[model samples]
Target: MAARPIIRFPDPRLRQKAEPVVAFDAELRSLAKDLTEAMLAAPGIGITAPHIGVLRRLVVLRLESDAAAQAYLNPEIVWFSPETIRHVEGSVSMPGVNEEIERAARVRVRYQDLDGVEHEEEAEGLRAVCHQHEIDQLDGIFWIDRLSKLKRDRLIKKFEKLQRLGA
Candidate 1:
């Protein structure tokens, strides 16, 4: 599979909610494969179909190089823990900027496998963080949306500067 082009930030499509995956077929599998290639090439642990302008509720993640990459179709977080943890998060769309994001320490997500088989599981630590992050993208919630007003303003300015400087 070829690596899909990752759309950059403020692309408007990233802000649009992704459509649910209705058909679990070879096309979906191919898209997932392309997403994995793009994610790995992006040097990011996680990515979503929206990142590549597919606008489908698909996410591919490889938290550890030693572990197999996971593809989740129509992934949604069903529960979250009261405890919260802060982790640095970024996006392939944004490239170089990342900030500490505070998210639930654990989450229970309901997702579909490649064959459209339903599965629900709880995740903790980094896995939990990654799940929340990607799910947010599916919901049209950008990671930077978690930041404070001042921090977000500063980040956009920096990102704009980078774009201007041809970063």
Candidate 2:
């Protein structure tokens, strides 16, 4: 599988909700592989199909570089702990800046494997953060939306400046 091009911030597709993955076929597996490759190329720990312009509720996460990547299909948060934690978060689509965002410290996520087998898992700390972040992406909510308007505006300006300089 090859890494696909990632859509950048402000792309309308990023704001559009992703459709659920209905097929548990080779194509879905291939997409999972592609997402994993693209995420590694982006040097990101988590990614969603929407990041690559595929409107599918699919996510790939590899919290540790040396660890194997895990793919989640149609993932949804089933429960969240009241305890919250603030972590710095960024997006592959919006590459140059990150903001501290508050999220559930623990979560119970219900998702399906590539084979369409349903599974539920509990996560905390970074894993929990990644789950919420990517799930928000799947729902067309950019990570910056979690920030204050002032912070979001400042971060977008910074990102735009980075893009101009990089170009």
Candidate 3:
């Protein structure tokens, strides 16, 4: 599969909620492949279908130390820990800037594999943060929304400047 171009920030599609992936067919598998390639090409740890305007509840993530990539279809966080942790978060759509965002330190997600098999997994630390971030995106919530209004405004301004400067 080829890498798909990521739709940039301020694109209305990014705010649109993704539809659940119902068919676990070859086409879905191919989408997973495309998302993985696109994310790796962006040098991002995680990406979702909405990033490329597919509007499906799918995500591909590859941590810095991972030996393989992982894709989740129709992913949703089933549980969240009371403990909160702050991690700097950014999106492939909104490149060149990031900000600290607080989220549940641990989470258990219910998702399907490319084959449509349901599975639940527990995650912590960066993995947890990444999962929550991607799930939020799937729900039509951009990472910037997790920030305070002041921070979000400031970052949007900075991001727009970067866009204007072709950075």
Candidate 4:
């Protein structure tokens, strides 16, 4: 498996909704493997297909320190808890800055495995946060979207300046 380059924020491709994986064939499996490798290489807990320029409904996540990495195909959150929790989230796409975002404390997700078997899993705590974040990426949403308009604008301006400086 190879590491795929992650597309950064402000790229139009990141705003495009991903397509569903119609066949659970070898190509799909290989893409998932490459995605997993890319996530691990980036030292991140979660990654979505769109982040690597693949417009497919796929995600890779490993929340627990000792848990094995898992890939999700056509993943979607089917249930969410009333309880809410807030955490500071950062992204590989954004690099240094992080923003506080509120998310559901618990969630139930339905997704397909490598073998194309459907499964529903309940997640809580950091796992829940990771799932929610990755799901948003599949929908072309970024963590900065959760910030206030003013704050989002300021951060974008900062990134733009950084880009201009060739940094």
**Candidate 1 C-alpha lDDT tens digits along 45-142:** 99999999999999998988437899999999999999999999988999879899999999999999999999997899999999999999999999
Tens digit of lDDT per residue, candidate 2, span 1-167? 45799999999999999999999999999889999999999989999999999999999999874369999999999999999999999999999799899999999999999999999999999999999999999999999999889999999999999999993
> Model 3, range 107-167, lDDT digits (tens) per residue?
9999999888899999999999999999999999999988889999999999999999999
Model 2 misses residue 78 by how many Å? Answer: 0.6
- Model 2 clash count equals 0
Tell me the tens digit of each residue's lDDT in model 4 across 1-167: 35888888888878788898789999998898888888888778888888888999998887667477889999999999999999888776766567788999999999998888999999988889989998898897887888899988988888878767876
Q: List residue ranges in candidate 4 displaced over 4 A.
A: 161-167
lDDT of every model, 2 decimals: 0.93, 0.94, 0.93, 0.85
Q: Which ten residues in a row have the lowest lDDT in candidate 3?
A: 1-10
lDDT for 49 in candidate 4 is 86
| Structural similarity to truth (TM-score) of each candidate | 0.96, 0.97, 0.97, 0.91
TM-score of predicted model 4? 0.91
